[model samples]
Target chain A: MEKGLIAIAAALAVMTGMVTGIGEASVARQAVESIGKNPDAADKIRSMAILGAAISETCAIYGMLVAFLIIFVLGA
Target chain B: MRAVFELQGTVFYIIAVCLAILVFLIILNMKLKKFDPLDEPKGLVLMAMMGVNFIENMLKKDTNKEMTEKLGPYLAFLFIYIFIANISGLFGLTPPTSNYSVTLTLAAITCIMIEYYSIKYNGVKSYVKKLFEPLAPFVVINIISKVGTLLSLSLRLFGNIIAGSILMSVVYQLLARVSALIPVIGKFNFVGVIVCSVLHMYFDLFAGAMQTYLFGTLTVAFISNELPEEAKGK
Candidate 1:
């Protein structure tokens, strides 16, 4: 049961990373496109995109932490 | 746990000493008016700006060319100092930020300052209205976002500092073992030293500074946006 739980946790971590990566990539791409259309506002758009990416990346980090806890603490 | 500090003493001392040096430098700059360009001749304005730039670059100046320049440096200084203090734990010293009270207090102060300034600059009515920006439903979302900022900022700093410290410890242990195998390689400790130094600078210094700048800049951006147009014009 314990091993099964660890497997589930690890799989969830991978999925979290994938979902966050996709979300951030799309947001970043749209931000760049906006900047390309309006060069004068590039700095504002870029900063917003970076902020979004940073926030999104937190999910992946949390996922990794959960995976580590399951593997090391739960002995899975 | 008690012996942890014994191993991390060097890191602690370095951080403390660096902070002391920064404080001293600030005092010296103030006393000497080291980079003050208030009285420079017209042609020397550029030179004066360059002088200011040089000092700022060395001292890790967090000030930008905007009105918030007055507040940026102090915020940056606090973030960098706290970050180093937290990461010093990896060297075996206890992370000050690991104490929830410390991080919570910092976050509270930042949130309070943001709200206080916004209200001060925009008046209560405008400030309250800002909570409902874009749509009425956004009022709750905006309030939650403010709370989320406090939580996220504190957790992000705490998480990164702790992780960096742990990674440093693991890398040190692995390298120590690798050096044990090659007796001659032990003499040239530069490899390990260089790698460790680069990692520490990137993880602790660069990221620390970036986080500090982000915090301060975000505060300024949020408050300024909340300000009345006339006040912002000034």
Candidate 2:
């Protein structure tokens, strides 16, 4: 029963990636549109987009960390 | 002592740092013949110049000319060290960045740089006041945000590299098992060879380069973000 619970918890932790993926998808879309409109500013736009995407991805990373802990530390 | 020394990733960390230093030393000691400005550069000179140009451009983008001049060498060293460490996985060594210790130390250094710049540019009075700004109770949240930058920076690099390495191993294991089901061809593990290389190209090469660039760029961004607007460079 405990093992089953651990598995479910791990799965739930990784589910945070669903939200993060959607967030970053929009970030990338807008970044591409901005670059298309201003070709000369592409470099600046690309860096800003990447930075924003990375910040948004942190919640998913934290979720993965928790999942790894649950599986490896608790389940073990 | 044995446990500390036996940490699996330490050796790789040392190897990566040494390799970066070795590259730096070799380039430092190089005696290049003077060439015409318009002539095509060759060999190590060309590579070294290209790397300098790239690092300088990156530094100039985030900070003022004086800040770049001061921080350029350290940031260049950082870029080289991180790139070497991240890509070391390609050569069969576990990338040191998969270890939280390595990433945390790098993040801590970045935090220190940010604080140092903030104090220097904004002054101690303003820095402390800004923390308590608009309300006194917000200090807790302000402190958390300061610490969050360190945690988030370290975890971003660590999680990405560790996840990639773990996934690669799992893929290899599954591929090996699948190949073992074949009769004679299973001995060569051809399935793994064909598929694992492509996966390595993405996980090791592409991810490593991207994370290295991101880490370096973010370090610059965080430091400059802390500086006053007047102090910020074009």
TM-score of 1: 0.62
lDDT of 2 at A63: 90
TM-score of chain A of each: 0.81, 0.95
Candidate 1 lDDT, tens digit per residue, B1-234? 466545443455655647755775576546555445475543335543554554344233222344445554655556455656545544546556655456667778878877876787678987778888889999889898888778766666656666677687788777777766777767564556667988877777676656655554555555555555666533
Question: Once model 2 is optimally superposed onto the true structure by TM-score, how far is the C-alpha of residue B82 displaced, in angstroms?
Answer: 1.4
Model 1 agreement with the true structure over A6-73: per-residue lDDT tens digits: 78877776577788889989998999889889999986686677677777777775676566677778
**Candidate 2 chain B worst ten-residue window by lDDT:** B27-36
Which residue pairs in candidate 2 collide? none
What does DockQ give for each predicted structure?
Answer: 0.27, 0.72
Q: What residue pairs are clashing in model 1? A: none
**Deviation from truth (RMSD, Å), model 1:** 6.9
Against the true structure, candidate 2 reaches a TM-score of 0.91
